[model samples]
Target: MKKNQVVLFPVLLALFVFTSCNAQKNIPVFSKVVYEGNDDIYNENPLKADEFYNPILQGTYPDPAIARKGNDYYLVASSFAMVPGVPIFHSNDLVNWVQIGHVLDRKTQLKVHDTGISASIYAPDIRYNPYNDTFYMIVTQFAGGFGNMVVKTKDPREGWSDPIKLDFQGIDPAIFFDDDGKAYVVHNDAPNKGEELYQGHRVIKIWEYDLEKDQVVPGTDKIIVNGGVDLSKKPIWIEAPHIYKKDGLYYLMCAEGGTGGWHSEVIFVSDNPMGPYEPAPSNPILTQRHFPGNRENKVDWVGHADLVVGPDDKYYGVFLGIRPNDKDRVNTGRETFILPVDWSGKFPVFENGLVPMEPTLKLPEGVEYKAGEGEFFPNGNFTYSEDFNSEKLDYRWIGLRGPREDFIEITKKGLKINPFEVNIKEVKPTSTLFHRQQHKDFSFTTTLEYKPKSEKELAGITAVQSEKFNYVFGVTRKDKKHFIVLERTEKGSSKILASKEIDFKEKIQLKVEAEGDDYKFSYALNGGDFENLGGTVSGDILSTNVA
Candidate 1:
């Protein structure tokens, strides 16, 4: 397979769930798999039995949380403010994943109104407790206020129950079920002043949870691990906590040093689930902070991990990491990556024996996975075209805050976008639907056919870093004359970067290309050659750190 190849895969878009196999049934089972090679056609052949990709999931599927029930594995990620929040995926072999549905598909399930793009949902933990035959998802709503909530259901693909607001004070809530059937909610507790005074001084707390009462038992709350693995160093942001018991020893894992450059995963062990946990001798069980950025090795910010044991009795860690495009620009945001863990030692470590992360790995023995038969390039790079023929839209397409389905209409021509009263320049949700730029060197082309009634109404393709930072290439009407305009917004200020008058009947095509650390916007008429409309915009401006 060549390095520079773009494969386009066309699949069905739905409001519920789309499965790769057994579509007729509510719980679909895999029959055949698709292999994502560097080609336009799907490799109908099954995997070579020993090879697999690193990022089982691509694009902005970050902060992955996984739970297993028998042979079926269910996965969920932090959807932030995107509608149909917390997408759930089902996998048989843990390699090929298909989007079943979202946990919060209904508007009533979550309140993302006026929430910033990056300030809504944080790290969410999904756990299946067989004791009650229920799947519980505990997460934080970080929009207008800090809210910790939980939602559960027996079936994840169908839908989830309404949010049960909890009294937890902090974020990144996780649930652990002991062998004796006692359930506990462990999470990063906020710092109380007058005690430890450091930048990231925090503690991990646990409380006895009553499923029937749908609340935590009062007076059962206490700090289990204080100030991370070693309190002396005052490790920063000890968040995303999960507890597991193996060999009668309770192992508590949490992310430390924050989520950026110094992000890491550490572990502590205790005889009891509630008290006096000791740090592992080899702390920071997994990290990429020690390594310098290298184009050849693109994975970085590797932390926020969750451990799951497969049917093979082997342990695997699914965590979040970012892949830089060029010059350390992270346009794809955080992505989900999985690595086999070696538990031979007192603690677990990545078994890859490489720095940062490996792009490929050998699958566990006797595991077979089927690709999407027609799915393309599943190894991180994503390319898809949306004709919007169906009544619903693709799950990959995201809107700001809350999505307004009324703005989207299926027309005989194509998907029609009735411009919302607000533009993308505002902090509120808009009529635009966006897909993440999964690859650094890729192009996104969209056709817009609209007759603007007023200058306030303009439809086009936008590359957004946040509500304050974005770039738009749109067409607007002035005195019955159509014009192609390019605008860039920085720090709440909008500027018309460039503009050109175009002879428009009713439609035009807009294209956005990413080359290295810059983006180029171009427009064309009736499927003609694309002409550059504005100067290049630095991709770093839309990076996760800056945005």
Candidate 2:
């Protein structure tokens, strides 16, 4: 017999024997294991899939602000334009978290169509007022000129009150209620107040506010800190100011150096909450420590950090970082990461001063993975594909704004996205392939096969966070020619980075990889090798919306 025939005979014989055995037992058999991951992290301890399939929270976009009430710990993250802004996750131990609910649910709180992902609620700081026994959520809505919006609820899950606008200028408003029962709001100056022009820098200011009255002291705003040091010299866009009083010293922590590569710190201290604050002698509390060659070594875009004390009384800091894709550019969106913080005299001391944490660190203790405990995935991660035949959209997918039910549908073949009234420029209530920010550097490829009858019909892959900034890789019909294009739209301009004529093929497979600050695009014909389209694109295209 031929070599192929000989090999097939044994395989067929083994399959026949296995089928007979299974039939006799009257049982169905599956070769793949259902559970995964090691016991060290999860309770049952299962084999973990490849890293791409299994994403543990890491890097920047974490924007975690945790509040501990008794044994229960509540965590909130910046949702930007994603519907259900401020994802609220609950955890007994800091390591394993389950999504409990979202803070903003009412239609009055968020408009999914007009507000893009980056325009929704910016950085939100969650805190519990012990005296009144109430949960307060303070978020900066950038769509309304970086104004602070306040929402309070006795029960975070259901009884949230209407959003009350706090008259404050600045993005990333943090609320702090002092021991004396007085509440203060600390934030940066508004962008249009000429701060972005004079020094190209905004001042970090503190103002007393009455949550009950829903009003600030009007002109009571006082500048607590300003850009001055080497990292802050060139009109640094200081934002996300968090204040904590510990050991008779008031510590002011804020992010500086813009929100991109080479971004560093600007921490200051003041004995009193209002008076002039002094910058730390060793500022820039943290940076991309993994890169050691230059003082400004670039890796992850780390900022928007929150500090919380564990039940064990140890302090931990959670912030966002971007992990670049294979090309060393980050496009997967920012991710959250945790680091240890120690007090040196009066200032916070980070190991190696301002370096990024090593990939491997001691996992937090007292964490037990509770499978099937969350509102979405009670059993941990599940398999998901762009294929639309599934009954409902996976929880992993999030619309920049709330989407209408008619926007998308599934058939046995694949997902069918109905054209909406909006386009890429205008915030569309329904858009194809909308998802939350996952990792910084990851490859997202999809097979889109659509025959547009007219020039209005378009389909493709997009890395979109907001209406103003996004990158689209797809085929557009112009005149009678079908053009494969990679276009990036930012501010108000849509520029085609690369384009080519499309060949009528079975399907179009579009792949985008973001390294550090660069993006690579390629298209393949059926299962053939990917052909590069053109010149390299800067990673900055994504930086605008993400930060």
Q: What is the lDDT of candidate 1?
A: 0.71
Instruction: Write one digit per residue (lDDT tens) for candidate 1, span 1-547.
Output: 1011111111111111111222121211111111111211113322455877667776678789999988889888987777768878887767778777778776677677687666677778999999999999999877645488899999887688888888878778999989999889999876565776676688899999997888888889998877887777778888889999899999999988876777888999989988678899988889888776664656777788998897678898899887776677677677888888889888888765237566767777777545444432245343465666767665666556666474556655666554445666556666666666666566777666655554545657777777677777777667877788888778878899898878866556777777667778888786688899877877765766455
lDDT of 2 by residue, 495-536 (tens): 888889877654666666544455677777666787767666
By TM-score, who's the top model here? 1
Task: Report the Cα lDDT for residue 6, model 1.
Answer: 15
TM-score of 1: 0.89
Error of 2 at 479 (Å): 10
Looking at model 2, report the run of 10 residues with the lowest lDDT sum.
7-16
lDDT score of residue 450 within candidate 2: 58
RMSD of 2: 13.5
Q: Distance from true position, residue 389, model 2, in Å?
A: 7.4
Task: Please give the lDDT score at residue 331 for candidate 2.
Answer: 48
Best by lDDT: 1
